[model samples]
Target: MLFAHDTEASLAAAAELVNTAHETPDGLRTPADVVAFVDRWSYTGRVAGDAEELAAVRAVRPRLERLWHADRDEVVELTNAMLRETRALPQLVRHDTWDYHLHAVPPEADLAVRILVETGMAMVDVVRLEELGRMRICAAEDCDDVLIDLSKNRSRRFCDNGCGNRTNVAAYRARKAGG
Candidate 1:
């Protein structure tokens, strides 16, 4: 694996969070939506289940999205800011079929803070390895999705939500018509 299993999971979760901001129409417009998202990510924590929690998580999405195009120094600064803001203190704990892994906050911390700390810890691994480039924006011309390129050959160039397939089919049709 390009990174620890949990790191990869965190990265995927972070991307999912960002993608939610780009969702059609309503787009994560409620606290219940936030709760459902946390449940889907298996995030264990205290959620206010109110507008405050929803706003905090929505705020985090753009910051995490910025990391996709940031330089190493910028990424370091942002990651450190996240750690500082959340007051993260890494502790190893085993839970739910998982072996020992870092948990920087109590399982009952605020949902936004917990999500920030977890994602920051995983980003620490990426920054340390100078592999932040693996965090990328989609290559599709009109899409703003973020993705992690974990492929050994670094061949992943688009988000998994069908943009790549659509782009490929359009290119193929263009070629056939020009022949």
Candidate 2:
């Protein structure tokens, strides 16, 4: 793997959170939607299940989205800000079918804070390894999705949900028509 399994998972989760705000008819506009997203990502933590918790996570989406195109210094500042804001305290523990991994906040912390801290901890690895380049914005002209390129040759250049294929096919048709 290009990074630790947990790091990859966190990156994927972060991307999903960002993409939730992209090009959708109804952008993450409800608490139920937020609950579904957290459940889909298996993000375990405390949730008051109120509008406030939903809003906090929604607020984080834009900041996480910025990482797709952030410079190294910007990413570092953002990461540190997340950690400091949440007052993260790291501990290693194993749960479910998973082996040991770091958890930087108690499971009872605010759900948004936990999610931010988890994503920030994984980003700590990315910054340390100088792998922030692996985080990317979709190359499709009309899409603003985020992606994590974990390919061996660093050749991944698009989001996984068909934006690349659609863009390439459109390009091919335009070339054929013009020729």
Top candidate when judged by TM-score against the true structure:
1
lDDT of each: 0.88, 0.86
lDDT of 2: 0.86
Which consecutive 10 residues in model 2 have the weakest lDDT in total? 20-29
lDDT of each residue in 14-69, candidate 2, tens digit only: 99888887756645788888788877777766667788988888898988887777
Give each model a TM-score. 0.94, 0.93
TM-score of 2: 0.93
Clashing pairs in 1: none
The candidate that wins on lDDT is 1
